[model samples]
Target: MYIGLLSYSLAAIFFLVLLGVLLTDRRQDKPSRKYLLLATSISILWAGMAAFQSGKIELLFIYQTLEVLRNLFWQQFLLLVLGRSICAEDQSPIIYRAKILLYIISALMVVLIIDRHLLQFIPVLAHYIDPLLVGYLVQAVAVLVLLEQMLRNTRKDMVWAVKFFCLGLGGIYAYDFYLYSEAMLFQHVDNMLWQSRGLINALMVPVIGVAISRHPEWSSGIFLSRRVVFHTTTLLGGGIYLLVIGFGGYYVRNFGGGWGVIAQTLFMFGAIIILALILFSETLRAKLRVLINKHFFHYKYDYRDEWLRFIYVLSSFDETIPLPTRSIQAIAQIIESPGGMLWMKRDNNIYLPVARWHMAAVYDSENADTDFIKFMEEHDWVINLDEFEWNPGVYRSRGFFSLPDWLRSMQNAWLVMPLILQDKMLGFVVLTHAKNRRHNFNWEDTDLLKIACRQAASYLAQHEAAQALSEVRRFDDFNRLSTYMVHDLKNMIAQLSLIVSNAAKHKNNPLFVDDVVSTVENSVTKMNRLLSNLKDDVRGSEDKEDIDICCLIRREVDNRKRAGNTPNIELICVDEKIISTANHDRLASVISHIIQNAQDATPVSGNITIKLHKHINHAIIEIEDTGCGMDESFISTRLFRPFETTKGKSGMGIGVFEAREFLQRLGGDIEVESEMGKGTLFRLHLPLSRVK
Candidate 1:
């Protein structure tokens, strides 16, 4: 008996539909249509084989030849399906070799038929045809393996399509296996069962068609569309219903043994699922979308799992440890973007792509044009998706189009966000798509993109700040070096001052040995004090030591008197050996410097007094002189800084600065009470621990 005319007609219509789709899409060089061509061509051959199953000898020969050709293309078709669906790599060599072998085998098979030689592989028995037995087992196994490989080899983002494609093939294979087994074992296969298999196979064409056609061209519009949700709900609901009913029937035949109660229970469950699906179609569609978004397309989310993960990474950062390249790649993977690169502004004119994650080669165009630089200068953050026409808010937006060669490419067009710390822009992050044309970024993706950008920005800002601190530290070292050189020079000047003083005293009295000895002795004392001061200024100390206030004052005043023509000096110490807690060498140097200033300011007979007073917490030594005093403006601004002194010829300007610093190290302070043209009083407040 011929297969029912209706099955043949429906199969013919499906074949024509697939053929038309293939021809139209293939004209446009669309790769998606190849799947349709293979499925349709195999189906048409199956229909023809079914039609001519019980015909005459001559007609049987023709139909059998067609079956051989069908088998040949079936193998080729499986290779194409797996290659396209799996790695996205073209492996047409498999098909080419299969076709060549098929031609040689077919010619041999034709000669066997004519000469009555053995071709025992044929399933047609003498009594009745085995009804798809020869074709079903081989094709089913081949296609099943192909689908399995496709599911296994594809990337995670494309795995859903691979899974659906496998399931579709599996569904068809199940039906084919059932009918083929029944025909071989029971010697009869139900027409209804075979027809159901064909219809199921037809359903898969649309599914697999959608998988190949719609995939790899993802748009925000498609994901956000209501129709996509509606279709998904309908398809998934129908699939579950069929799955339940099919498995339920199978269970009744096997485990249930066709039990009435088991059948009824299974039927009820299927009906309930179907009824609920129909009743709440709109709600179910919306629910399906929510499920998909929650599970897969959550990259564009504001408060998604991706957002939380990104924030968690940002918050738990170790600034000392470097960020991994995989971290940036994870951002791109999460968002389904083509590539991403993190950029930081190193200085005014240069931006560097420090970290990169991409499937393709990343472009590193260091020097952007003046306008591009100016754009970054003007705004802390920027994003250009090649569709910069949409950004009406950007002034001089034409600069985006004027980027360097590699940057002008769509791969470099990015969504950039500036990382700011303390209202200052530190760096920018960029996400781009040039290789994979699918732009999976949505509004939710943009939100997550911002989150990724923010996380990257924070890390980059920290790194840049650390780098700045390193530079400042180097500058400080250089400044300290300059200070050391000047300190050594001051020691040499002190020694030279002594030599000049001694020489001046003995200039007219060569035989006055007494005068020479006293003068030389005073010079040696001054030199010892100056050398000690020089050592204390260069290498600092924190220890508190004993200080002789009267002795230190007398030594400093004598040095001033010997060096200059002024001579009215008196030392009035309440404690002749007043000791205090201080770095004694540093304190003595400060005392001497203060006295020299007083002596310089004193007139020809002006009084210079060094008075020491001991308080409960500190010992105060006041050096008063009738000489020029300091103004409030000069004292406040220039007192502690270098190159800030009143005396023109005698001062190196760092004396007061170094003196104040020395006193501070000893846990003490220096205070000044002065009037312009009147003598200045320098008071040293030394901590009591420095007393000896």
Candidate 2:
């Protein structure tokens, strides 16, 4: 295959692609682009004609004509650009000169072509080395002249828009000058140079495309995809980088003849050097990302990315960073703030620094009624301190005056962001200045920061809520512990009351004296254990020790017997040994409580039956009382209620509630059944321990 044909084919394809861009580009009503489109079309035709003109002497004229038209169209396009640029508003006579230049070019086309074809017999024209080739020489000089004037006359500030264009188009015309000058001097075209021209022109297409992009007047601002800009930029930069690295490695491996090891070492070190700079110098990368976001996008930040990152930072499993500090960090990253302090309102109604991220500890706090606090609550806007310092009148004046000494005195105070939760100002974060970026603060930044702060506010709120709940649980545990203590005391007092009431009657009974000693010892042991539990101050620790269920019931029955013989006690247990894992003191107190209630409910003549047996891995204790019975409604609804009791003033009504709860904690539960004018039965189910 012919090399020129292949090169021209590729050039034609490149020009066609450019033509598509022009056709599809949303032009901002620039009539100049239409000339560009025409010029591009002429390039395609010019290259295509050259590609097909293989040794065809007749088609040579058409190809040469196409070249002239392509040049003329390109020059015409430049005239239109000048009309909009340097020569715009009657600054120059480029339009009129372009008409005169076109006439001169038309005269050359006629004189050159006709002389070579029809009037070659004339010695004067023949002696002058190829009139057609001279015409081509003149066209290249004219293009160079126009390019020079365009570059020189363009305003200094507007030079960038024309520079790339001039370089691209000038390279083409300059190559033409070189090619035609050599042909005229030697009287024949250089075949190799002519073959390479198509490839050279194709390379300049990208440069021209970039030039068009630089001049925004070439297209309208219909839409610009940020993702396209970012990815395209990344790909271009990466391509350039890989090309450089590939060339460097080629040089290292091939050119280092005797120093192979040394060359390899140097190459490795070069990579390390680049890695070191990338690892240590973050300012460049940060600035680059910021620059791309600030310039290319319609918005300052990618909200979706920011939101995901914010949530991840807040909910990360890394516990070394507490919730409050993570809250500060999440907000700080949005604005590229280096450090921050989170001020949260404490229980004392004072705003204090709950956490600080990359900042010094803060000891200052503000009363809730302070003007700053009130201002933050009323007006929920992200306060830019620098903006406030510049224009104090725009902000609420009261808040500015009430700012603390530490805050006002700080050197790099940047912004104060309010963490607003459901319309309430939960807290505010103080963000410091971004490290080396002189970023222009705008409403977009504020809006994004506000949303992020609100999200962070919820996280901090949940954290605070969890803390409050935990504190409440601690107090609740203490209150329940106190209630259990009081209930235990009530049982102990009943035992003492029984002893006091029976001391006179049993004073002469030796066996009764031993029973009195045993009762006192049991009460003393319970008091000591209560003291130990109070000292420990820990609650909610279930299952302290294994209890012999059989012995426990019998003792509880005997203790209730000593309380008063109001109701005669009966014990029935088939099992000799039934072990249960439970708190010894609590289980005993609960059993005693149930028995005391049964005794109080029964008449002096009525009997209380305590029946215990193992049924399906559970030690079921049935306490039935033959006395004034309860209705089914009371047993169902109010029997085990925390504070409902028949003996209103004398009873602490949490006994049954506590009893049922304690039983459930030990893999056991209580069931109550009763009817009006009938006896009530209390059935307790305790899961029998695996141990004998």
Candidate 3:
């Protein structure tokens, strides 16, 4: 049997089988199913006639009649499937009239094909008109109607379900239209098209089979998976490969002398081996899948699964695992990267490799002054290294140099995602080449990466803040302990001063000497007590009492006068006792600290004056010294800061701080007014004791 005949015979058998199934299956007796059944039956008959009666004039008329009837049935089937009203009364007037006109044209063609003698009545019509050509034209119109219906009514979501149906039926009539139109124009059919027509029709049956299987009624039992498309594509590719091999073999066999047959056979076998190798390559398959999914699929990712997996990785929170490592792994897994390194920002415009997952070859640190860092910081770009290497112009346009040698030296670096927070470049992470290297990064990849970077940067920023806060807390605790120790030392110094004052008078007599020794021993014991209190973590306690503020000021002035070398110290106060509610020891320590500071600052000739007076409900004490005073900047910025002082090695700088804190505790405050190289005034405000 001829190849064309055999192909048509096989197609007829398939369609007949399909028709029988549709008829016998009582469930598929709906109007749409019946219309489809009728169209398929017509197609089967047409194929059979074309296969067996290619040259018979009588059968040619039958073939043409079947073509017109097939066109009409298929057109009606499409109209019904698209939910268009087939009944003339139910349709709009214009649609009804158009359908009637189409029916009239089909009927006239059928009549012309049936009665050849009718053509003799009009010589001009006979000369120009051919029944075979008229059949193709009518079929072409029917194909156009189906196309219009498909395009107009098919929704995007339903395209996959009805895709095969459109391709199958559309392919059959479209090819017929082309074949017959060419035949009419050239006066005969093209041999190649005529021979392959049966094969083309047979191929469409499988596609139509897919459409029927996907139909709502039949979809449950016969379902198409992604594997079906993959296998179909593979089969089509294999067919093309074989066709190429056949052409190559024919060329070699005809051109070569005696070795032609042998050469052709060897060439075909080698080609087959090469084609098999190419088809089975995993890398090529991955690349092809990526290309198809990127361009063909509506969604790039299965967001539900991707989101769940991403959250799982981020929330893992294993203590043994560093956060940066976990962060890099979480982002890298999204793109299926093999490994990556995380660089965190360090001081001095540097980024250091803080954590890595499976990538050991990256440098320990990189300077942020590099062009790459500058570009990423300015644009907040997620750099694709492969694209950078290939298209340096993209980066160059943005004022970037080629990929740095340091980065290129790291063999697997594929992407650099910047960790930016609040317009600051925290650092960046460099992902190694993905397991599927052929998949290029798109906007989806960049968007996901940037979001992940933000999350990671937040984690890093929080961790750094927590560390700084902890250090500040430690310093606060240390300062508190030191303040208590310093207050204890001041008490010890006061005890020593009393002993020193009586030493001269008591030195000559035994009894007085004994009393002097006892006082010295008491002072030593008190000094030991202060040291012991410091060791035991004793905090300063407030013991508030109604104390004579004038008496306290007089006693401090007298003590300073006795200890002074030449600086004149004078006290001016009213005789009426001015009492204040205060912690006696703490208030005394504060007043003493201020007086000592003034005396130390004053020259031998400078006079220090202590004046006390009552103002409303408070007692005001002014200690004025003709001393070298402080500038405004020093007084404003550092005067009360602990351990900040101009006394170099001699002063601890905590005196003003301690004094200010103590005075505030006693419901009082201190104010200073001073100028460089002139005089300093210290004013103390203390709440008066209500007992009066």
Candidate 4:
């Protein structure tokens, strides 16, 4: 095989760049800096191999030692990277020791590959037993683990650039793993796999450049198209292989060999990872949300359907119902919070846990105590576990959790956010300590937590309003039913009065005329007044007109006399031509009803007096009677409700109700002030207009 000189040159250049990356990372934290150094060391070994492959063996034994050390550094690098990714920062010493073990293993492997006597394995250069093959395999796996961690920690609403760096670098590492594993284990390398690895390297150049330059969040939309092509090709390659296995099995049975097995394996693994990334991409999720909103009416406000459920839960005090935790957990996972609990205030004083989902059963309502309440009251903000200090008084005084018990459990809590509504403290949420992380929560995590908390609060508020609305609707229904029965009864009474009056008109020809006329007049008058008021009550308004006060007073007096009134109807008018704006039909009905009630209350011959006076902008009509007046209880409860009456024979209970309703519509009011024994005075206050 004619190994290209270009490969060696490129490898040497990358080795130098790795060294530069390591040198620049001197001031960085141990594990990250150490990993870079280890990567650099490994690059040096590969450079040695590259030089040796160019037919130079100046320090073959020394190069072998360096290769062994490089291999050992790689194991440490992988452990450190994985440990850091999982936030086991303090555990790197253990991993560093693991690297020492790998170094010894590498030395043994080197002796075996070079001498062929250690494990009966021959060292093959750029062939089946190449040391670089395993190195690439380990790197590829490390890259995949790093990518997974990056994706897990990424904020859903983060800018595209951070995501680009994460996915691009991740995708590259994954591709490199497949290519390295395939090339090293097999006799020949597939051109497709080789090209894919090259593409990954090409994609990684920009990512590494940006990451090193501290532009981790820069969007790489330019590469998105390229990635789509790469994924699509992976999918196609998988499909072709599957089709070959399913439909071309006869051809495979005759021609299948190592090449066929390798092809199928690569296609299957590549297709799965690529398709999984595409499907799980945040961009894809966002697009799905938009699609749901456009195509599905039920998911309009929230594409995830959580908002609607949150609304339903909020409007009621029914905390027994459960809510879906998927969206909340998804959000929490995105923000790197291992455990989350959402609390809502019920009835202002009591707090209830509405939702609780965690990576473990680390928190429960048992931890909710008086201290938690006080802590929420004192500091109504999001508390990040990374920044929070242990204080017994904070949660203990409020009875949230016992400090001793909490400490003994080795449970670490990182963030607590208060759910606030309109400046009133509602409740608070707590996030368990993040796993494998010591870096204080990032801004993206905080922002996302804030958003989720805000969303939960909004849902609670909406649900509460909905519950109240339902109650109001129930009250409205009750009022409607009561109103209907009263209205119908009033109409029936009116009809009975009419029938009595008709019989009275024909009484003289049949039987006792005086008794009949009196009975009919009393019934008819009572019924007529009740029905008129009922009509006003039903309409909820009155007909408006300007009426002459003197005329109305005289008419009332004459009517009383015509009805054989025992007590005289007295009239005192200050202004003869004083006119008042009123509903004439309603006012006449009100005046007649009042006079008749007054007359009934008076002794047979006791006097009833009416006075009409004009005050500034008001026509004060007063009717006084020496009748049995109302008590406090009568006036308070029974005066306004429809169908309440004092008179035994003619009281239909609609008079005052109608009178109040009519006067209200005419911009006036009727007031009654009466003692239990003294005469009653009914005063009608009407807005008066000066006569033209």
Q: Model 4, range 1-692, lDDT digits (tens) per residue?
A: 12433443455565565456546533545555556566555655655464554444565555545645554454455455456545655766765675565566566656655664543344354333655456546645655664565556545543232455455456656666676677765745575555343334443544443443332222121221334434544566557665655445445434667576666556556656765786677656445544432322111123236434534443434333333243345445544567766555644255545556663332222233466555555655455443335433334444454322432354556666766666665666656666655463443345445566666666656655765686467557647855875675576567556657766566556555565666557767765665554333333145566888789778867877897877777788877888886666667778887887788788876778888888778888899988778864466435756555776545546677677767766667677777787878888878786557
- Report lDDT (Cα) of residue 445, candidate 3: 81
Better of 1 and 2 by TM-score: 1
Query: Candidate 2's error at 411, in angstroms?
Result: 22
**Global CA lDDT of candidate 2, please?**
0.76
C-alpha RMSD of candidate 2: 22.2
RMSD score of candidate 1 (Å): 18.0
Question: Model 3, residue 453: what's the lDDT?
Answer: 86
Per residue, candidate 1 scores C-alpha lDDT tens digits across 239-303 of: 78777876766666566554866775767676777767665765455456666554334233435
Task: Output the TM-score of candidate 4.
Answer: 0.30
lDDT of 3 by residue, 28-104 (tens): 65788878888889989988987887656567778768878888878777766655423445555755565676688
Any runs in candidate 2 off by more than 4 Å, and if so which?
1-6, 25-30, 54-58, 84-94, 110-115, 118-128, 151-160, 182-187, 214-217, 221-692
For candidate 1, the 10 contiguous residues with the lowest summed lDDT are: 217-226
Greater-lDDT candidate between 1 and 4: 1
Task: Give candidate 3's error at residue 239 in angstroms.
Answer: 3.7
State TM-scores per candidate.
0.41, 0.39, 0.43, 0.30
lDDT values for all models = 0.59, 0.76, 0.75, 0.57
Candidate 2 TM-score over all chains jointly: 0.39
Sort by lDDT, top down from the best: 2, 3, 1, 4
Clashes (N, CA, C under 3 Å) per candidate: 13, 0, 0, 26
lDDT of 2 by residue, 85-106 (tens): 5646565575777757776875
Instruction: Pick the TM-score winner.
Output: 3
